[model samples]
Target: MKYLLNSNNNILNKLKTKNTLLAFDLDGTLSPLVDDPSNAYIPDTTKCLLAKINKFKKYKVAIITGRSIASTKKILGELPLTIIGNHGLESFYAKIEEKEKWKKRCLILSSNLKDIFDQNEFFIENKKYSVSVHFIKKNRSNSTIKKLANTIKPLLVKNEAIILGKNVVNILPSNKSNKGFALKQIMKKYNLHQALFVGDDNTDESIFEIKKKDIIKIKIGMSRNSSATFYLKNQKEINSLLKLLNDVQTQGINFLCMNMD
Candidate 1:
């Protein structure tokens, strides 16, 4: 994988192509990962770049996150961009009353989880289609998450899955509706051929592991384990990417893009 902020490997030129989509994962990509998940927010510098990127006529900007749209909206602050939430489920878009049959099972799981964890210690967020059990590093013992998983595993029925994410445990109604699947759906709807996705954590891996060559995947943190083609050094380095994108649009590609090592 190449270092995104370190070198210009013609990746920006590829992104400038027609029918492109620029997408991000919120928590560790756009916003700093805080001890309390609810307090996470995109910094002013990053948010400003994202807003500018959204206005660019060449690409469609989107935020695909694990947070529910309701929660994402609270932190997103009214950016007129495409937002897909709950890893891929939200808004009850279907017409059939029978379509959301899994909600009842998820609700039961959510309720049962309450008995297993302390509300103060664990942040149990019920996103209707998924349930996330988050524990901060300082509060978590080695066996805490594992024991919790062991207990929850027994309760999982058909169509349910357990995903181990960064400092959190996620129970999804179905693993099929991930960021990669959601990104493809939007691409199909908009007829976008080129795409860029920036994310951190296991949930974002689906997007990184896509088989397409046109899709530029950048994992927030550099890791050989990830299938991403490039990576920004860390979450803080994301500003360099956003800045380059903004400059590419406003300052002309040749003038803004300087020689890189």
Candidate 2:
């Protein structure tokens, strides 16, 4: 993949005239991932850029993430965009549910699996919303997670469930509830000609690979291999890119309106 300078002003110019959408991954692309994922926020530069981008009536911006919707709205606050949460398993327009009652919509992983969370010592550190069974944990065997998966498979066989493996095992809803699916939904809903997706994690690669010929796929963080069309060093670089896009959008709008007069 090429590491393009954040100077995609030409792309923004094209987007100004056509139906376009911007989608972002929350944890690492939009904000640096901290020890606690719920603490992530839109960087100042990103917020400024998004504000500018939102000015275009035809341009739709959305934040797609693996975090729950309530978790996202808490830290992200009210941004001028839509948010696809829990890897697209849950979504909210804005203020649909009070914060306290929002946690009820998470993908209903089998209640039988609740016992697995108790049997493992590492999982004890996990809280209610976030839990991962790390197969590679030291002193623990890899088969532990597999056995757990095997046990849960029967219970979820009738429901929508899938086993996704990364740093650990995740039993997520098997519906079309992924970043890629969410992006497509946004494009169709808005009738966009093209879209841009930026992300920086294993789960994000699911969307990165699905970028159409016209869409731009950007990856953050250092990695030799990725399906991303472009690469940035980290969230700071992503912030810089957002700032540049904001400036371009401001200039593009002024240029467009001036010609209309």
**Each candidate structure's count of clashing pairs:** 0, 0
lDDT of 2 by residue, 1-261 (tens): 766453332544556566678888887677766543445677665677677777777668888877666677776666757888766656542233532222331224424455555544333212223234443343334466567557556654443444343334554534445678878877887788788888887677777788478788888865665788777766777766665456555565232111100
Model 2 worst lDDT run, 10 consecutive residues: 252-261
Local distance difference test, each candidate: 0.79, 0.61
Top-TM-score candidate index: 1
- Model 2 ranges off by over 4 Å: 6-13, 92-111, 118-155, 158-168, 222-224, 252-261
Any idea how many clashes model 2 has? 0
RMSD of 1: 3.0
Overlapping backbone residue pairs in candidate 1 total 0
Task: Give candidate 2's root-mean-square deviation (CA, Å).
Answer: 7.2
